[model samples]
Each structure stands twice: as C-alpha cells, then as structure tokens.
Target: MPVVFRFFSVFPLWLLHVMGAAMGWVVFAVSPVYRKRLVENARRAGYRFGEVRAAVGHAGRMVAELPRLWLGAPLPSRMTGEACVEQAYAAGRGIVFLTPHQGCFELSAQVAARRWSAARGPITVLYRPARQAWLASVMETARNRPGMLAVPTTLSGVRQMIKALRRGEAVGLLPDQVPPDGQGVWSPFFGRDAYTMTLAVRLAQQTGAAVVLARCERLPWGRGFVTHFEPLPVPLDERLESAVLQINQAMEHLIRQCPQQYLWGYARYKQPRAEAAAGVTE
Candidate 1:
C-alpha cells in the first residue's frame, strides 16, 4: 500500500490533479452534510450563497491540487506573492506560522520551505498522525521533505518543534486541529465554542517567535498560487483560551480575504475531545 502511494506521488502532476478533482466532486455529490457545512461557514464568513458556491468551486481547485501537495510538487520559484517571513528571520526571531484550513495550505508550506531553505532556516509543520494505521505509512512517506519537518501533534512532537524554534527555525501548525484530551480548550470561533489547539499559542509564547498568519490563495485558471504573510499579534500568556481566540481571529481575517478556499466541511465547533472518556469502544 505504501508502494502504491509512492507510485501515485511520482505520477505526473497533471494526472494527480485530475484524480483529486474527481474525488472532490464525488464528495460534493454524495455528501450533503459537507455542502451544508460549507454553506453555514460561508454565511458565518459573511459570504452569500452565490459566493459560497464560488468558494466551493475554488475548494474544488484546491482538491485537484491536493495530490501534488502529497507528491512533493516543486516549490514555485517566481513567488510573485508577498510571503513576508524573511524580515522576521533576519531579526533572529524564529517564526510561528498559524495557518487555518484555508486555501492551498500545502502550497503555503512548500513555498515557505523552498524560499527559506537557502537561508539555512528550516520550517516545521505540526500534523496529527493518521488514525488509520495504513494511512500513517502513506502520509509519513509523502510529507517528510527537505527543509520541511513534519511534527506530530504529540507531547514529544511539541518538544521537537520548540527545540527547532529555539534554534531560530520556523515552526508551523494548523491551529484548527482538534487536539486530544487535556490538550485543548473550547474557544469561540465564528460565534460558537470550537475545540481549539493550544500548541500554536504555547509555541509562540515559549519561544518569543514572531507569530504570523500565512496562506496560499489560488489564482484563476491554472495560473498557480499566491502565498501571503502578515504579522499577527501574539498573546504570549500561560492562559491558553485567550491565546486560542486571538489565533482564530487572525486566521478568520485571512479566510475572509479568500472565502472560496476556506474549508467548510470541518466540524470546527465539535464538542471538546473526550479521548479518555470514550475509550476503546470499537
């Protein structure tokens, strides 16, 4: 199975795109709940239904590009977009990238990794290990690339990421990931209590890393993406809930800029993790 995934990863980028697009459409057709969620999120973001449809279509483009993301697509060289981490890196202040499930997230990482690789600074991206054992092998093989380190959402992984930042390297994470028991706090996102990961805030506070919101916006047609960077105010306090709210607010600002790319299907407001309480039912 890992071999099959590797083979697919090596396939021509165009073929991978096609398969991703097909998979996305299948989801849109068969999953009414997903579409509904997307609609609700769009509304929360102040986008009308017509705009949400357009956003969903743009998400389809992101889906098409997903395969390339896992397959090590070469980073864009002429990154005409303004990804502003260079300034922070120059100051010897490590960067903590707070990204939402919006736009071409993979592209954002790929572009950052490529751009900063030459500077001898690496980027660590936080990720959750796949729940399915088989998918774990597939994901690990696909994500570990030069200049980019995949940090799992575990205590050990958190330590690894902090160590990297202390060395003046950038560490990234999707603050939206639902953390396990004792690892998250319920915070208001889009007017609802969503279980939010505290890792992003904690990392920034611990390392005094420059907190920034980064994203990849898809251009019309096959023109490619524009990754942007902006400084985000870090609430560097031991109090986690306040920090989580700030992170969400920052990400929400970015998502508003490109509503179409924001992923709406995620159960952002799901109840807090009950990992310990719901033990081994299956």
Candidate 2:
C-alpha cells in the first residue's frame, strides 16, 4: 500500500487534488453525520454556508497533499520553526508543542527534529495507535521518521512524556482529540463543551515547560507546508482545568484564522462518560 501511495505521489498536484475531492465525497456519502456536522459546526461558528463549502473543498486538497507531504517533501526542506523553539530552550526546560488537527501535523514535528537545526531535545508526539495491526504498521512507518518519537496514548506513553520533559526535551500532543474517560475534562470548544485532554496542561505544570502552538500550513500546488508557532494563552498555574480551557481557546483562535483547513468532520461534541459527563477530573 505504501508503494502504491508512492506511485500516486508522482502524479500532478492538480490531478491528485481532483481525485481527492472525489474521494472525500465518497467518504462523506458513507458518513452523513460527519457531513451534516461539518456544515452545522461551521454555521454555528458564524461561518457562511458557501465559505464552508469552499473550505471543505480545500480540505479534500489537503487530504491529497498528505501523500505529497510524506514521500515528496522532506521535513527539513518544508518546515520552518520560528522563535518558538528558541523561546522553549531559553526556559531551560522541555517544550510542549500543541498542534491542532489541521494541515500536515506530521510535517510540523518531522521538520523540527530533522530540519530547523535547533538544539531541541527529544521530540515526542502523543497519538492514539491504530487498532488494526496492518494499518497501524503503515502509520507507524510513515510517522516514525528520523529524529521523531511516538508516544502511545497509554499510561506507559504518559510516563515517557514526563521523562522527556524532565530531560529538557520537547513533547507534542493533539489536545483536540477525544480522550478515554478519566483522561479528559469538559472544556468550551466552538461554544460547545468538549472533552479536552488535560495532559497538556498537566505536563506544563509538572515540568515547568513553556507551552507553544505549532501549525503546518499547506502551500499552494503541493509545494510544501509552512510551520507557524504561537504561545499558548494558558498561565503556568497548577490547576489543570483552567490551563486546559486556555489552550482550547487558543486552538479555536487558530481554527478561526484558517477555518477552511480545520477538520469539522470530527465529532467534537458527544455525550460524555461518567467521569467526563459528571465533570470529574481526578
């Protein structure tokens, strides 16, 4: 399958984007809920229906650009880390890069570890491992590129992240992702309460690391992704929930900046479990 994707990567960008539009529609057909939610969420956020449609189309293009990101563009060649990393190092602590589920998230990390040429410590990304063994294998190989490490969404992985921070390395996590019960807190996202991962805030407090936002913006014609950085709005307080909400707002701010690239198909608002549903953090 990877070989097949490699072959497809050689195709023209315009053609690939067209194919991706069709592919996205196919997926949309199977998941009406996602399609409806995408529209509804955008509208609720004050995005026009026509604007949403255009953004959705750009999303298809972003999907097609995925293969290009991995096989065609090298991290060092594509991504640029700004004062973000330098600021992180000045703290003399580990860095926690909070990336949204927008535009080539995988590229942002690879570029930092392999390209930017910074004296960054260990770069750890927190991700939910694929359930299917075969598909999981492909994902592992594609993301586990040079100079980057994968931390599974487990207690073991959590420990590894803590260790990395203590060593003054950098760790990354997608706070927008839904976490298992007991691992998340209900926070406001797009004006709706979402079960957001609190680990990002906890890590910041535990390690005294500076929290920063990193996003990969897709360039036109599949040329490459431009990496942008922002400081998180959260304070360095010990309370997890307050800090978590601050980060969630930052993510929403970024989403508004590029509404078209944000992943609206995601089930952002769902019934919570006994822990999260009851607003229990500990």
Candidate 3:
C-alpha cells in the first residue's frame, strides 16, 4: 500500500484529479447503497440531486489527492479570511478549529499547521486509527507532519487536545463525524436528528479556546486548495445540547458554502459502535 501511494504521489495533481473523478462516477454507478445514501443525505439537506451531484466526484478527488498531500512535496495553497485567524491568535487563548467532511479537510490542518505552528504551537488533531493494520501504519507516517500532531479518538487523545488548547495552541476536529455512543449527543443536523460530537463545544467552553470554522475549497484542475477561516457565527449556549445544536448549525452553514464539495455519502446518521459505550469522557 505504501509503495502504491508513493508511486501515485509522483503523479501530476491534475492527472490524479482526472482519475479520481472517473473513479467517483464508477463507484456511484456500481454501488446502489452508496448512491442511495448520497442522494438521500443531500435531499434531506434540501439540495436537489442535480445541485450536489458534483460531490460524487469531489469525494473521489478527496481520496485521490491524499498521496500528493501527504507524501509528495507541498502543493500550491493559500488561506483566506486571515483576520479571523489573526483575531483568534491575538486573544492569546487556545483555538478549536471545527471543519466538516467537506473539500480537502485533510489539507486544512496542514495549511494551518504550516502557517502558524512556529508562532503558536503544533495543532493537535483528533483522528480515528484505520481498522486495517497496514493502512493504520501508513496513516501514522503520512499524518505526522512537521507542524501537526495526530491523536487517536480516545480519552487520552482528548486529554492531549485539552492540553494543547490550554497551552494556547490549536486543535482541529470534524464535529459532524458521529462519535462513540457515549461520546456524543443526539442533535438536529440539517433538519434531521444526527448524533453529534460535543467535544468541540466542550473544549472551547472549558479552556476559553476560540472556536474557528474552517473549510478547504478544492480548486479546479488540481490548482491546489484554499482554506477559509471564520469565527463561529453564533455564541454557544450555556447548555450542552443547545451548544451541540449550534455547532451543527454552524457546520450546515459551512457545507452550504460549497455543497458540491461536501461528502454527502458519508453515513453521518449511523449509530456508533458499542465498544466505547462505557465511561466515555467529555
């Protein structure tokens, strides 16, 4: 797998995207279950199939571009809405970056880490270890970049994020990803009840970290990506449920910005595994 990834890593970005789009359509055509979920999720969000059909290809691009992003040299990229990030940094408090499964989410953290790690500190990101041993080993090597730290989705990992935040560093999370049974609360997402992780809200509330919304937009023909940053639109409620709902609403807003790039096929509403159902930490 590593050898395959390394071989693909040398390919031109444009070619990878081209292959990826074709792969996306192939998957969409072959898998009825995947196609159904993609359409259903988009429709539930009030988007027509025609409106978000490009997401089918974008999802493939997301995977295809990883080799270049992770193993190859840095690609062309930039950040917009710098003021939001600047303002958050000026606060001298920690930062909690919340991004959904949209565009090149993998690159967003790399961009942040490269741009600000020296000035602030390494951005600690929460990630679930891949179930496959080979894939997990590859991911560990790929994600351990210079300015970022990847922690597992465990209690100890959560503690690492907290420590980073308290030290005035940054931590990134996909708040829309369903958490383990005991780690999340049921909340409304896009007018539907989805189990949402409360860690993003809790981190901010506990350590006074600034909550920044981030989205990485994939440019056409693999021109590279642009990560946009903004402060959370609304104040978080004092109540946990209300705050989780607010976070979900914020994610909805981000996804709406470029619905075509969002991964509408993800099993966002699926029940979490039962293994972590006991003694879950906040």
TM, every model: 0.86, 0.87, 0.97
Mind sharing the TM-score for model 1?
A: 0.86
- Tens digits of per-residue lDDT for model 1 on 144-229? 78788886766667788888888889888888767776667788787777788776777777787888788887665455668888
Whole-structure CA lDDT of model 1: 0.72
Residue pairs of candidate 1 with colliding backbone atoms: 55-260
lDDT of 2 by residue, 189-267 (tens): 8788898888888888877888888887766554556888877764655677777888888888878877777777777
Q: Which digits, one per residue and each the tens of the lDDT, describe model 3 over residues 1-282? A: 888999999999999999999999999999999999999999999999999999999989988988888899897899998788888888898999999999999899999999999999999998999999988998888888999999998878888998899899999999999888777899999888998888888889988889999999999998898999999887788899999999999999999999999999999999876656322244
Descending-TM-score candidate ranking: 3, 2, 1
Misplaced by over 4 Å in model 3 are 277-282
TM-score of 2: 0.87
Model 1 ranges off by over 4 Å: 1-22, 72-83, 233-239, 276-282
Q: For model 2, what is the C-alpha lDDT against the true structure?
A: 0.73
Ranking by lDDT: 3, 2, 1
Output the number of the TM-score-best candidate: 3
Give the clash count for each candidate: 1, 0, 0
